[model samples]
Target chain A: MTIAVPTWRNQVSPVLDEAENFTVVEFKGGKQVKSVLINLAGKSQMERIRQLEAIGADVILCGAVSNYYYNLVSARNIKLIPWLRGNVSTVLDAFLSNGLEHKRFIMPGCRRRRRMCRRFGQINKRKE
Target chain B: MAKKRQSTELSDKPRLTNEEVSAILNSIADGVFTVDKDWRITSFNKAAEKITGVPENEAVGEYCCDVFRASICETECALHSTMETGKPVINKAIYIVNSDGEKVPISISTALLKDKDGNIIGGVETFRDLSMVEQLRKELHGKFVFEDIVSKNERMNRIFEILPLIAESDSPVLIEGESGTGKELIATAIHNLSQRRDGTFLRVNCGALPDNLLESELFGYKAGAFTDARKDKPGRFELAGKGTILLDEIGDISPALQVKLLRVLQDGTFEPLGGIKTLKSEARIIASTNRRLSEMVNEGKFRQDLYYRINVVKLEVPPLRERREDIPLLVEHFIGKFNRLKGKDISGIAADVARILINYDYPGNIRELENIIEHAFVLLSGGVISKEYLPDDILHRKSEVTTGAFSNVDDFQKRMILDALRRNNWNRTATAKDLGMHKTTLYRKIRNLGIELPARDGR
Candidate 1:
């Protein structure tokens, strides 16, 4: 059962009309597609993470991940798919075609330090 | 016992020191009057004469109620209550019908004057006029609600009317305008007015965050989904259930997010970070962009599909220069608002300052106008705001060089008049005929333009 994590960065998630944030799209095979939309009432990043966990989200696909939150979510056994860029549709197509291997997840604190996580198979090429 | 009775007899008749009593009563500035237990006025000082416009000869020994035009002393008087309760009354406001028949506001403070044995003998009451304080309160209340969101232009009025209507709808709305046009304010107004008025109105700057971080922020991740995934998280879509969300600077968002957004539009469903269960939400979307999305699409920078989805309803806010008529109204609103906030008594804007404001093009729109007004209020010396308070940028713009040729409508009209006069060799009749106007009207226009005709020999 391959589940899809809908995100604002990549097109794996369903884009809600009037939805301010990204939501998770569950697809069982190609036919069963159920969407769960989430909006963080507050702008705080910590509150957003907590709300997602409460809703039983398994994976997060995003364009960028802060190290502090990345570590916090990773410690809970949730898969973090980061560094997914492009339009919503293009990202969704990429997710549907290549699955998890094609997606890029950045390590927490990599933004400031420019360090790449070993799990994603990329080394820190950019100087901090 | 006979020696003690002789000492008491000497002390019973204490010496009346007139100078000391007069000095004590005259030293204080508030109206002071002493009334005995029988309510008969015993003493009235200089301050009392100024407050009541009555002299001591007319007030002394008079019944306090009869002198003050009251039916009785203890019925409704604050001073009587203080005397009876033996407690000092402090700053009680009362309306008095003075000798001129005009109602004057006064604050009265009273205390029961006691003798050496601590027995209540009489009451002393002090009252001061509260007309100034009442004026200040009126000014403060005027400053609160009348000042913000200034603009009297028809366009702004129209916007005020439409704002409530837009808020009533649940459809996705796209606000397009130049920077500093209060697009975010319009979005907020819509959220505040809509059925989800009480719900959270989340705003995300699409241009500020990159793709991956933005995605995760929008859609939560599962715990241990990756090495750093600490716990499962819910995204903004789920968090905004039955609430309104604002996608600010939507033009800067990536195309990938656009596709995911399209799916949500197709079906209100999305999956969590690593969870198998699909979540459903009914979050309303509102998007805003200062950049021209259509132009961006043409340049291949933005997605057409996403543009269509967000552009379900579009509202364009015009710049300040385009609505010059609203400048006066906005100026008044800002002045009133800032006056109360800054505790200034600024009455209004100077005519010359208003003229300068109307002429200048506000690149920052309403927000910029508000800032300028606030600055002006702070710098205003007296009740009047002058042009000197305005910033240098507001005074000067890059001067446009005109080659003495016709550029605008006024210039074109001037050029046409000059050409006709020259062609007709300064002949008024011929010039008017050539320009297709009445000779008298042409003469008036020539006078208005201050056109000089060359000297000609009398024929």
Candidate 2:
């Protein structure tokens, strides 16, 4: 399977709206076999969609995406794993092992707010 | 502060036992758990229980994926992968459905747990709750309003600030905007704010009527003034006595009528058709046009002196594409408006619907946006407005969205300016520095581009 990750430096770009480069990693037997850098800067959204389709990526992993890009990407049969934040190498490794969930990858403030009262054995009143 | 106190209390306690380790794990704020090679949960922490909405007793001994219900469990197991690759994964972000079936976003980290013998045992995972971030993002969408007008765009906000003041004035206010840019709305606002608001507020579409009819309409016709003049009739000006008269499509008026209108604006006096006696108009004049009157003046289609006479105060409503920030607010406004008018209860618009709306250049401006919402209302039975209900032309307006630039010149320019402003943290100085231009030049570009400077809050 081939995974395309839009990158800034070595990590996934924070926002896909301005992402200009993508690192396509080809995996075989749950391991990275090959990787290539594709720069798609200065391209229209339609052209970018076509380029991604031509790349034949099975999935795209990136950070936050606008609604337009999300709809377009989903319209094509590409699986999108968005709102990810991590080094490209680590993220790819995690993907290969089915371990893409981790603390360092969470975007700020997306954590669930749970009632701590029950756990602490208090009155169980939820935090306001 | 509470967390600090808890940490201090924890430091006072002794450690180095299996039970102590388990207790410490449970006390940690982030959810932590250990999975055996078979993916069975060997240990579950208090934070894990709280985050997953399941008790430790229930979570223990169960398959990690079964307990957490993470989307990756059925497809890609992080612990399973961590076991295969000795390298631990750090800070992988994902979402999982909890006991209540709510999708909770989380960030997780995994590492191989080793015994005292230095042999790999089970894999450990830690995840932090990220609901606050998502909530904050949602909270930031709506909050722009000016009378009935809704917009976050700085230009619109500026116009909003001056709208009341403009309305209070008795001058011949010239409102220039593209079609559907709310020229008539602004004219109404001025009239509503003016002292003459209680009197008859009359509107005449100068372009909708020919020169002869427009002349008779503006200046009352006497009996036998024309073939249709059967009796003495009061024109829009006389009808709008002591009130406000909005001359819509003013640029479409003929030169002869322009001279007559210019005289009225110049001295508030005009002669009724077929009447030798001159009449005085107590009405306030407000002119609106989608055409560039200055260009018309240069083109010789419109009288230059008349343009100068009527353009006492000009309000230029920025096109929708130049003020994309206003799109969300406008969408919300339109949705509410249509909901009341159509008696339909659409909760809101889907993200995709908003995306398509914002991406559109809006050649027809706010009126087009209202029409789009009304169109959605016609098809929307209940629930939210989705892309399925959008007009076919808008849904199929194909353009690459990746660049965030539209084919419309105004849209592309505004996007560029906004992109740069955002990149520079909205600091015009830094933005100018990064753009390799002087600050004043940047300011001019911002003004020319119709980019509004945000309020004091810098939202």
Candidate 3:
């Protein structure tokens, strides 16, 4: 699966740079997955999402996402991993080791009821 | 038989046509809804459908509460009360939850719908969407007040009041103050509150650019004006048309450019570089200076004409020492601001620290005070700010009492004598007696010290 990361100024992709701690990694079938990375250097979030979707990214990793934007991206079948705060390499290592399995990524302003709904859907239906 | 037939026909006649009533109700942009005496929904129009998101088909046969779920009832509902009293209710703003569970603001009016017999049958309410008014009210509340400025001094307050008034007029304004006195803040407040508020507010730091670059930035540049001028670009003046442009650090501009600026101010026109067409200038100009421009004019460093043109209205901001009373207040304000920014919960400064702050003459003024507060907050421990947190300059300044800078031995002696006398309640005879000197000489010394003697013996 191809993963996309949005950065404002700093380069945080750990496969390209080893020293940075807050990096993003992709995996498929329990093996390290080589992915296509898209740089949204100076564009706004909406514009970045449009660019990423145009390049056919399956998952997006970013520091934070707004509620409206989360809904828009989720509606487009793109998986969103948010609140990934750390150095590039450490975050990438954690993702590669399956340590990010229990991390909860909630959009800003998403109601508690909606989170509960998502939790129930994941538990009973195995809906990813 | 004919009379019976005519009576039956009249009895079977239809009421007002549905098409006519629907057209009338639908033509009104305001939401129109009617409820019977028992508060059952009798009619709902297309506008009501659009406003409440409940179609007429769903609303016609249900009670108002069942259809709209409004918390409004006979005693609480303004519409119901007006209908019961046969009076009309004027515009009233009310918040209601729409079908999508979004709170919508609405201005509504209600009246009693009566029959030909003058008896109240039902109530009709007409309401308009109030989202625009709500948005404008929010915008108005979001306006930058004088408190938005960080300074607590009287000089800044005076500027805040004068800036809005100056913004109303079309004349040029010159703001003179020390560096970092928030000259830019004053200019922005003027533009944001002015009649040209909707227009752009452009700034060009006169000291930041060279003469050629500054000229090109102020006056537009046409294609082929210079090596980098591959395309035409409108300068700040034209872009700030019908708006305001702040010429920051205007004192540093060269004399030649000063002449050009003076011509633009006088004629309200300037030509772009490498272009023959002279564009009509309509921007209001506000210039700031930290240097003494009038002195520069005297020394031939600045043009007299340009100085006078920009100085149409001069505002001089006093330095912070002149407003010492505002220092403690400013310190607290800055502490609060930085505490939130730095995520430190420093409650306040200690009394001794406050005293030192009050006594010190801040040469850098408000900006200096802000820096000191920020520094103190950074080093503060256990949420208490003490003198130890202060910079070395503040703590190391020599005390006046310990400096010993008096003119002569006599001056020191007089000061000591007067201090002793005042401490002893000005009893000169007793003071002389204490110091083993004659009362007359002590009196002479007191007189020489300029000490006022109280009237005695009614002489």
Of the candidates shown, which would achieve the greatest TM-score relative to the real structure?
Answer: 2
Candidates in descending lDDT order: 2, 3, 1
Candidate 1 vs. true structure, TM-score: 0.44
Q: What is the C-alpha lDDT profile of model 3 across B239-332, one tens digit per residue? A: 9989889999999999888988988899998989999998988999999989999999999998999999999998887766676545545675
Better of 1 and 3 by TM-score: 3
* Sequence-dependent TM-score of model 2: 0.47
- Per-residue lDDT tens digits of candidate 1, residues B30-129? 7788998876788888877655545677667755543443211223576678877888988877644333222345788888988878888899888776
TM-score of chain A of 2: 0.81
Model 1 error, position B157 (Å): 4.2
* Candidate 2 chain B, poorest ten consecutive residues by summed lDDT: B137-146
Q: Rank by TM-score, descending?
A: 2, 3, 1
User: What are the runs in model 1 whose C-alpha is more than 4 Å off?
Assistant: A1-128, B1-150, B225-229, B272-276, B378-382, B398-459
Per-residue accuracy of model 3 over A4-104 as CA lDDT, tens digit each: 65432243221111111222345678665664434444453344555667666676554433222343455464665543333444455654454433223
Number of colliding residue pairs in each model: 90, 27, 7
Alpha-carbon deviation at B93 in model 2, angstroms: 51
Clashing pairs in 3: A20-A89, A21-A87, A21-A88, A21-A89, A22-A87, A22-A88, A23-A88
